[model samples]
Target: QWDKPLTSKVTSYLEDAKEFVPFKLKEVESAELINKNNIKTVEWVEAASDEEEALPDTSHRQEVTITFIDNSMLSGTLVSDTPRELSRLSDCLNTKESFIHITNGERHIHVNKNMLLRVTGS
Candidate 1:
């Protein structure tokens, strides 16, 4: 009996199914609003560890030429004796206000604690 075809009942069943599933656009808009505010904050916290590992090690000292914004140059062995002094000098070099350019010119280079000692050594 269930397998028998019913042409009159088919139309009524299709109409009822269509009425039950209604489209709501407001739900999609609310979801987008919530995601936009929360995603950036989550990404920033996740990236913090990678940022710390990328930092350079300034414990070891090396010879570098210090170039002032005025175009003057100073060549000396970078004194990394203390962490504070090394940090201060590194900040100065990294800044656009004062910079360091490493090079060897005809003039002799010198390294001193308080002053720059440069001579041709004639």
Candidate 2:
């Protein structure tokens, strides 16, 4: 499992490509490396390097609840290499990015940054 080495790309809001889908290097580069099309936003998900391990490390992940502009809520994990405070998190959100990737184990969800109201960690 996870031996083929693949990346996931969501083509539309309702359509999602499987993480194990085989894609040509050019397609991966075009969709992931460079946003040439400008129509789709690609997020890369790397396979867990340690295949023998049953659980992946969660030390660098933060449990977060994201509130949207419409008052909707989403709970997921925010992966960060270094420790982060609320102030730092707020600053990053102020940059007006296009999407925020919320990962949950082997899956992830991309939320439009413009639609987010705030992110709270626990």
Candidate 3:
């Protein structure tokens, strides 16, 4: 009878559904899995070349006033023969700090090494 075959098909469908339940539970447990000891550790590395080139020595020593765009001034001894770099500006003026002050009439402002105008003998 057609009714007998329909009942057999429904029974096989329930058996397949039962097999899928364990697979769904395994997927949920796998999603919650964690491993704590797999973290990466970093180590510090030293440079291969430790020696650097020495700076050039200069003899033209004189007091120089550097003026910024805002008319601030800085007076310091100027040493030539050194390369014109931002970091070397402090050493060229023989100053320990990064900035210097220059005066423009009644107002005074701070200037960096790149604002130099001329170097005259003190």
lDDT values for all models: 0.31, 0.51, 0.36
Which 10-residue window of candidate 2 scores lowest in summed lDDT? 5-14
Per residue, candidate 2 scores C-alpha lDDT tens digits across 1-122 of 33432322232321333223333475455433332223222344545762443223532566789887778888887643333453355544554335555676666566666666788988
For model 2, how big is the CA root-mean-square deviation? 9.3
TM-score of each: 0.21, 0.44, 0.24
- lDDT agreement of model 3 with the native: 0.36
Model 2 error, position 76 (Å): 0.8
Cα lDDT tens digits, model 1, 1-122, are 33322211232322232333232367574322232111111101114333333213554345665443344555544423235554555453443211121223222222212222221110
Model 1 CA deviation exceeding 4 Å by range = 1-60, 83-122
Q: Could you give me the TM-score of model 2 versus the true structure?
A: 0.44
Decreasing TM-score order of the candidates: 2, 3, 1
TM-score of 3: 0.24
RMSD to true structure for each model, in Å: 29.8, 9.3, 32.7
In order, how many clashes per candidate? 0, 0, 1
Question: Which number leads on lDDT?
Answer: 2
Q: Give the runs in model 3 whose Cα sits over 4 Å from its true position.
A: 1-58, 82-121
- lDDT-best of 2 and 3: 2
